[model samples]
Target: MSPPETDIAVRLSGVHLQFGKTRLRFDCAIGKGQIVAITGASGSGKSTLLNVIAGFETPDAGKVEILGDDVGGRDPAERPVSVIFQEHNLFAHLDVATNIGLGIDPALKLGVKEKAKIASALLRVGLDGFGKRLPPTLSGGERQRVALARALVRRKPILLLDEPFAALDPGLRAGMANLLLDLHRQEGHTILIVTHHPDDVRLLADSVLFLDGGHTLLHEPTAQFLDHSDISAVARFLGR
Candidate 1:
């Protein structure tokens, strides 16, 4: 049940962002239903790139399109993009199901069909019966799952994840990575995940975007990148 491979889910053309005197630029196109993993140093602009694509931050130059529409001028809500961050941006006051349902719409007007879809999404993320639990009561990995469930319920064509498993232990991180791959296959959503972990890139990425010094140095198939000497250099730089 892979997502339909028909169109480009995300496209960036000469995209550039700047902070004071520093600049970050990206030029790429990602096809529908593929997982693109971005890896780089802490301040290499990985998260900023995700933010720009999600329409949370406007690039200083170039064009961004999602689902065939130019979205550079659109607000975050106007773009068909969902982001899952390492912080698990769940409402502490709300229960899991409610948090996921919020992804439906802030207007609070979901039809019966939408409610059912939310329920299914929650189940898909292994939070089936824990929807009544608040964020404070959940473990780190469980909370991450909840955040992912929220993203799933949105059913957006494109998803952006910013080091969502950084807080988990090794075993837990691997499990989450597998779960992400499964969800990607089942829901057919185009996914972009940012991580410094080579294992994660090896396990989940269809392609890799290697960023260094605020620039994309390489974009290649995961296996090919692994065998490349440049990837080894990145691994050593990250102490991986």
Candidate 2:
């Protein structure tokens, strides 16, 4: 059977945010079980928009809703969301197991069940025997995979990625993209990510959102967004 049509995973209405000269206003809704891509130029507030949904930034004038609950003013930890940044936010001093275990228990305390879960998450991300290594010892892509394992273990319904693979080279980036797609298929969570990788949008996103000057320029199905004959704003972005 198909999924419910009314299941709205994220809703933002009349959101307003300003940073001196740059201001953003937005209104949008995303369906459940979708990979939505948020794309824009450098100063277009793409990351800032994700920050708002993830509860890292508060809208000056709007409501933020997730999983059918109004979560305006909620703390990042209090919300049902997980955020992964491009920096791979791993602790250098912590081992892979410790870092991944932090998702379940912040103190790094682990019991038998939690240990099993951590090990499973590790293997799921293709890091079977690397759990004892420190963050600094892992390659750039491995570090990203470790971060993905941590995010997956959170078991949150919504995952927000702010260009999580932006720093990787082309080959490594493609591999990580496939890994992410595999994980997304298994988890079936609602994913909203900020990325410049056209390959990612083509491979994973069901919808594409374009933003500029703190405002939503367009929100359309992935195919429609790409096929439109008059996306001057987007065309210029691609240097076409």
CA lDDT of 110 in candidate 2? 90
Residue 53 lDDT in candidate 2: 93
lDDT of 1 at 179: 94
> TM-score of each candidate?
0.92, 0.96
Judging by lDDT against the true structure, name the best candidate. 2
In model 1, the number of clashes is: 1
Residue 76 lDDT in model 2?
91
lDDT of 1: 0.86
Which residue ranges in model 2 land beyond 4 Å of their true spot? 1-5
Q: What is the lDDT of residue 214 in candidate 1?
A: 86
Candidate 1 lDDT tens digits, 1-240: 222435778878899988888899987778788899998778888999899999888888999988888897899998998999999898999888788888998775878887787788878888788878899999999999998988888878899999999999999999899999898888899899999898888789998888888888888788877776546657674464
Worst 10 residues of 2 by lDDT: 1-10
lDDT scores in order = 0.86, 0.88
